[model samples]
Target chain A: MTAVLTTTAMPPAATAPTALRRALPLLAAPVAFFVAFFAVPMVVVLSSSLAAGGAPSLANYARVLLDQYHWDVLAVTFRIAALTTLAVTLLGYPLAYYLVRVVSSNALRRSCVILLLLPLFTSNIVRSFGWMILLGRNGLVNDTLVGIGLLERPVRFLGTEMGIVIGLVYILLPFIVLAVGNALATVDPTLEEASADLGASPFTTFWTVTFPLCLPGLIAGVIMVFTLAASAYVTPALLSGGKITVFPMLIFQQYSTVFDVHYGGALSITLLVFTLVLVALAGRIGNGGGDRS
Target chain B: MIARVVLRIVAWAVMAYLILPLVVIVGASLTATSYLAFPPQGLTLAWYGRMLADTSYVAAFGTSTALALAATAGAVLLALPAALAIARHDFPGKRTLLSLLMSPLVLPHVVLGAALLQYCAALGLMRSFAALLVGHVVIVTPFVLRSVLPQLTPEQRALEEASADLGAGPFETFLLVVLPQIRGGLTSGAIFAFISSWINVELSIFNTTAELTTIPVKLFNYVQYTIDPVIAAVSSITIAVAAVTIVLLDLTVGLHVLSNRR
Candidate 1:
């Protein structure tokens, strides 16, 4: 299969100069487009962040970093992101494992996968709107809880951290499922079978063999969920109901309402850098896990 | 065995959790009441009718459709060549270029939106369709690139070379041989790109005006100020569109995503 694949997929061997020249025409349009639109816009934001009062200054950074309000918002944002990632991983891992390793019916698994992708494909606004109605004071969730004696009265979900986390997890859960599902699918089941036949318990086999293999995918999903939950604007905006604020919301406020590009630029860069650093750390951790066991 | 049973129960519950909100929105949209309700007070299409009666809703839908179509087309045009280059030839900065294209997937759309707003304002094109198109293209191109790159394998290259050696020109070879091979990837990628552009809020919010808003951004703005059956109706329409797209996607490409097949 590998040899067949290579023969079918690989380009004809060509000299480096000729291949570079041939590839140039194809690369030109996309490279130019990204440089103009993506790269240049990012550069503009970076420059704006570094300048204030028509001079290059760190005032915007100081304002963003030194302010207590910003720190509070960052704490809320990161906390929500961290919690969302954890919740998604907990919920998603089992579903992925069931789908990949346990489920016997192909049709069932496909339907479940479709169900997973539907919410992902749908707009966050729409999904969050759904949650808003369901979580309202007299909504079905509260009604059911009260009816079942789970609560004495309707509990507030809107305008709270828990509400934000719920919405973010719902929006992000599919990433974890897909990532870990694909990873699970690639693991050789025979290894687990061998461990079992060699007198290891199922739990021991999983912890010693199966779990380590899928760590990369789990980490990828965790990073994706974290980044997405951290930067999520629409879900947090709707679910928070103006009572909670995340980092992206602050950035949006500065640009959309305050029209303070310098401050917003600083906020944008701060969020971007923070997300990048977390992602890097997660990658390192994932690699470390891969190296161990 | 007990653990397996537990896993099964948890999986089903998670599936329900995954689907409950969408079911509620679709249900609430049919409520006869002026306010939104699930297990809807009474079934009625009146809210959907009211939505249809509004010209702004109709216009926003039209604008969103046009923008998504344009962006998808632009992404396909730009990304296909880039995919071809990356798959067919090794070049300097190939890894960097691929990451640059795909970075939008991970970058915060809010930041991108704000950056575009600032950049376009500097370029004298703020809040225009052009500005929206460029931003949408930048973001959605990666979808097309990712999907198409994997389809361009060495075996496919051999077929293309065979067509060329048989005296077919580059364009003809691409049209007949290469296009057919990557049709699945390209179609799926284009659909994904279309939907991503269509349903985008954060990115579109920055460039959109009251006159030229997309459906998702419009819905975002409306849902903030009010929660009514009409809003639910609008949400349901988008939900229906998403449902249809997914169904079409499943039928066409076979969403065997969880299959343990290599």
Candidate 2:
């Protein structure tokens, strides 16, 4: 979560003078650990991405950017991610609100939380594999649709954008629910009550007061969903049935199948940069809303 | 009344959406069909038996368990010291250092996997258990650090100081005073770290070979080529493991992550 990233980004304050010296030794291990493992690998990736067949050139980037297939893949990736974010927010916010405000039973709320987190703990492969079964022809989804006379034929759910979206929404919905639920729980009920007391209707109270307060959580969830959905490889790979492609699929293909680290590095760097940019923008929006609130 | 009804309907529908895949997987694993069938022609545990019978599945499970355990332990050891440093210290570029350590959470794992693969190949450690373990540790450390750092409050520091003043050595203070206070965080973090490593496919996929694969990666490879009850059985076992872990976490730390509690 961004909690780890944001916590790490805190500007060092020279408030505790004597303790600073005491903490120096403690810092050595983590700093060294990161430098050796995290930073060096990243540097290797960057260097590899830039170096193309023993010469530094933008040819890899040129190939990535100029390729029509890469564009289509990137388009598919972002389209699915954006749609998944929208769907999860729409579905998750209400559920979060319901859990926060409507569900009064402590046991029920706890159960819902557990249900939400169960998929998160499961492997993406397992989750997507579940969808692969359900979304296939003669799967439960098709059987139910046919039984209900909703379809003349079994709708192809596997290896489609819709299939990928469904899997992603399932995978990422918990983030939105948790984020919005936390924000909703912290909202002052009195403010909504006051709005009602001032002749506002319940809907108006929710829209004018409650919704604004939970916006940060909603935004946070959206950003997390966006970034994760964008980068997700396993779900799309499984659900896509090898017929559909996303940006991560390209990176995976390059590294795994082609064994082309240089081209794979370029693709990986592209996705990483784009994802980071989107996340940064989302953070800015969330922080801006936080300040306004 | 209409509004309330609509909200209830939407909430229930969303809940169904969330639970649908999991239900199907568990159900399919119980099917008598050689191939996966959702409404599961007839209930049977033969698939589970088949999964258990496979040596590769068993080996992958063993490897995943060992890797997750080792990675979680390494993350805790590394993160505990790091958390103390970040929470209690004031150092130049500390923020950057922290971000570098924690950036793996947001950075694409496929990218990290590729990078680590490339990096390890240079050092002659590619496709080995060591290469995989180090990658897993890097990704999982942030979980422990994030969870543990928040627990090291000024109040906790005051308690640590008190322990030190009471003739407790540094190690004794950490063991008796600091650790107990952060035990919940450490436990939750370690659980999360372990689960993250267990569920990992991206990083592990890069380092895992046919002979040395994790369960998830193995399933990933198999599911691509075949869709059978055995794969369902493997997937179901993982789902069951995940369910057990969640229940354990719920019982231990309480999974009311979004409850209206301070």
The top-ranked prediction according to DockQ is 1
Residue B137 shift from truth in candidate 2, angstroms: 0.9
What is the Å distance of residue B253 in model 2 from its true position?
1.9
Least well predicted 10-residue stretch by lDDT in candidate 1 chain A = A1-10
DockQ of each: 0.60, 0.57
In the range A1-293, model 2's lDDT, one tens digit per residue, is 23222222334454555445556566667677778877899888888889897999888899899999888888889999999999999899889999999999999998888888888899999989888878888888888899999998999999899999999999999889999999999998888889999999999889879988988878878987898899999999989887899998888889878988888889999999988888898789778877775
Candidate 1 regions with alpha-carbon error over 4 angstroms: A1-17
- Which digits, one per residue and each the tens of the lDDT, describe model 2 over residues B147-248? 898899989988887776687767777789989999889989999999999999988999999999999999999989988988888887898889899988
Candidate 2: misplaced stretches above 4 Å? A1-20, A288-293
Per-residue lDDT over A1-293 for candidate 1, one digit per residue giving the tens place of the 0 to 100 score: 23222323345577677567777878888999999999999999999999998999999999999999989999999999999999999999999999899889888888888899889888999999989998999988999999999999999999999999988889999999999999888898999999999999999999999899888889888888889888999999998989988999999999899999999999999999999998999899889878988
